[model samples]
Target: MERKIVKVGNSLGVIIPATYLEELGVTYKDTVDMEFNHDLQTLIIRNQKTKPNNKDHLEQVVKGIVDKYLKEKGL
Candidate 1:
């Protein structure tokens, strides 16, 4: 698909079709990755990389584990 870049206020931007946004679950203010294809001489726009979560469900899990330990050890 081809699109034309237009100027908005002080920034140049492209209008993405709503269908693609819905399919990707993208929303306004979401971060995007901009890459240049050196071989094809083109630009690739994608979702920004996400950081890995090292503490998934940590609060509840820690509470449960501590409670169980206290009961088992009679602390």
Candidate 2:
């Protein structure tokens, strides 16, 4: 589905179809994570509350684990 960018108060925005939003299980006021793939020239969106499989999320989890371990070991 193609959508045209329209002026939204000053910034340009695209109006996402309600069907697509419903399929994504997201409604107004819900947060989403958006990433742009430079190579593919695409935009990817995911529900913020969902478990992320991205590298940044993985690094955060690892850092948390390491921090907890260091704290427990009093190091």
Candidate 3:
């Protein structure tokens, strides 16, 4: 695939297609890590390493265990 660099106000940037972003599981307005490789002469884009909100996950797990324990006691 080929891309064109267009002028964006003061700087020039390449317009990434929506399909590419969709395939990468990222969308507009999301922050991504971009790196330029001098050896390979290529650009790399990747999703940032961020942990999910695990508070809800922990709460659900505790609730499930409590429910199972109560059920076993016929409560």
lDDT of each residue in 1-75, candidate 1, tens digit only: 788999999999989998877655668988877789999998766656443254864675688799999999999
What 10-residue stretch in candidate 3 is worst by lDDT?
A: 45-54
lDDT scores in order: 0.76, 0.87, 0.81
- Report per-prediction Cα RMSD to one decimal: 15.7, 13.4, 14.3
**Candidate number with greatest lDDT:** 2
Q: Write the per-residue lDDT of candidate 2 for residues 50-74, one digit (tens) a residue.
A: 7566898789779989999999999
Off by over 4 Å in 1: 49-75
TM-score to true structure, per model: 0.52, 0.65, 0.61
Q: For residue 8, give model 2's deviation from the true position in Å.
A: 0.4
- Residue 70 lDDT (model 3): 100
Candidate with more favorable, higher TM-score: 2 or 3:
2
Q: Rank candidates by lDDT, best first.
A: 2, 3, 1
Decreasing TM-score order of the candidates: 2, 3, 1
Residue 18 of model 2, lDDT score: 89
Q: Quote model 3's TM-score.
A: 0.61
